[model samples]
Target: MSEHQRAMLNHIREVNQHIENLVTDYWKAYSGIDTWQFWLNAVLLIIPLVFLLIYIDRRRVFQILFFGYTIHVLMNYLDITAVLKGLMYHPYSLLPMPQSHLTLDASLIPVAFMLTYQLGYNRRINQYLLAVVIGAVMSFIFGPIVHAIGFLKMYHWMSYWVLFIGDIIEYIIAYWLTSFFFHFYRNDEPTS
Candidate 1:
């Protein structure tokens, strides 16, 4: 690599290391087990998973799990992008990963979407409508509540409406992908 390129790479690495260190410090000071924020984050991460384990449809376990996994992946990507762009951030979290608030990105939101998808599948309800409703609840209600308690903070024109729209879009994408894959899977099954 050229000298300038190497210098830029070094600077980026330094910044990344600094960010990791800051995240660890913040977690230790405010997000550890002694704080209520930590407990809340822990609960947010655990309860939804428990519900999913207990209530997930056994007949369609793989399909439901795949759908939820898609949601988790999409949200993690969005979370990293938003944090990197300074659009939003989690001040406290169960994990020291600077790009995501693990409770919401990996647990609560994905599990919520999974259960919602399961409900729609079982009832043959409209998923688009479910997406919108769930999006609103997560973006407006849960987001604000988390913000109010200092877990999340929005910045740089990132409003609740923006989050609402993003949530709906991601949900639609995940739903479409999951349905498309399972449709083909069903079609390819051997006839009795």
Candidate 2:
């Protein structure tokens, strides 16, 4: 390999090592079965996920699951970017991983959006309006409560408005993509 390529590889290795160290330290300091924060994180992650699994529309399961998964992936990506940029972070976590807010990213937020999407689909409500309402509640109500409880912390010009706007955009994108894919694939099937 070229010298430049070798140097880049070394730099990548160094960065990975640093990330491993940081995660180790964080886990040691905050994550454990005995910790209240860990239990709280578990509860936050599991309850919504269970409810979604149990109550999601069985007939429309594929559509709702696709939408929810899209939301989860986008939110987690944005959240990881925010953490890397020092915009926000979680101090405690249920699991030892780089993204400390897995409970919120993987479960709570996604499940909430899933249920909202299902409701909007079933009732023929305007999805965009529902997104707005969900975003507002997440920003004004859930955000404050989580912040007050010390589950989330913002820094360096980050605020609840950023979270709200990001969520709204995510919802729109997920809804659009899921609708497109479902319609595209379903169109290929022969109508009886």
Candidate 3:
């Protein structure tokens, strides 16, 4: 092989070795099953899921499930992006993924929004208002608790307000997308 090719290969190998070391250090520090944080994250991921299974409205099961799924997908996407961009980090994680706080992004946040959507949809209350309230609780209350407990770390210019706004926007996008689909299926024409 050419000398330039050999140099490039050496660089790639060094980078991979560094990544491997990081993974090893991460597992040693955070992945222990005996740790309280791990157990807490595990419960956070599982309890809401069990509750959703037991209490989800059967009458509008499809709509609620789809909406929650959309929220979960977008939340994970945005979370991974934020982590990659160095906006925040989760010190403890239940899974070994690039994005930490899997429980919150994958389950709790989505389930909370799902229940709020159901409440609004069934009771004829304004979903947007309910979402804003949820966002406030998540931002002003839950976020601080999580940070204080050492589960989350915010860096750079990121703060609870960013989470607050992002949570609201995520809910709105998921609600609109799910509603659009419901309308399309029922009326065969898209609604505004």
**Among all candidates shown, the one with the greatest lDDT:** 2
- Candidate 1 whole-model C-alpha lDDT, 0 to 1: 0.90
Error of 3 at 133 (Å): 0.6
Q: Residues 21-42, candidate 2, lDDT per residue (tens digit)? A: 8887877776767778889999
lDDT of 3 by residue, 121-147 (tens): 999999899879999999999999999
> What TM-score does each of the candidates earn?
0.96, 0.93, 0.87
Per-residue alpha-carbon lDDT of candidate 1 for residues 1-192, written as tens digits (9 for 90 to 100) = 999999999999999999889888888898888899889888899999998999999999999999999999998898889988999988988877676588998889999899989999999999999999899999999989989988888898999999999999989999999999999999999999
Order candidates by TM-score, high to low: 1, 2, 3
Off by over 4 Å in 3: 1-17, 188-192
Better of 1 and 3 by lDDT: 1
> lDDT at 163 for candidate 2?
93
